[model samples]
Target: MSTATPAHSSAQSGTAAIQSATIETRDWLIAAAAAIVALIALYAVFMDNGSLISATGDYLHEFAHDGRHLFGAPCH
Candidate 1:
């Protein structure tokens, strides 16, 4: 919540725009939080210098990131 809001308040603005924005924010927050958690878990898994499974997960995540970057989305 910003201290300075736009001129269009809930009363003046329609409900649809507000609802959509709220939903989008919720989705973005969820995605961001999940990504962060994934990173932290990955770090923890590799903390002991990693077992085979941990190393495999790290490689898989790197591969997934590379693929996403190449295609511009999770699977293009």
Candidate 2:
């Protein structure tokens, strides 16, 4: 009879792979949550029209930033 460790087909291999996948998925979820929170905070800060208008000028400043072609002169 052969005498080998018989580790070529071990259950631990599949378990390790599953654990690695779970860890990777958790990392992605955390990163996504952080990004979403950051976006929300930014939106709250910029959504105040009065503040934005006072900071710059004109309430339409935010929209104009998207494209300068609409305005008569190029944006600074």
User: 70 in model 2: Cα distance from truth in Å?
Assistant: 22
lDDT of 2: 0.60
* Model 2 per-residue lDDT tens digits across residues 1-76: 1334446445677788999999999999999999999886554344434453466554454564444445333444
Q: Lowest summed lDDT over 10 consecutive residues: which window, candidate 1?
A: 43-52
Per-candidate Cα lDDT values, in order, are 0.61, 0.60
Question: lDDT of candidate 1 vs native?
Answer: 0.61
Separately for all candidates shown, the number of backbone clashes (residues 3 or more apart, or on different chains) is: 0, 0
Q: Write the per-residue lDDT of candidate 1 for residues 42-70, one digit (tens) a residue.
A: 54433322333654755554545655456
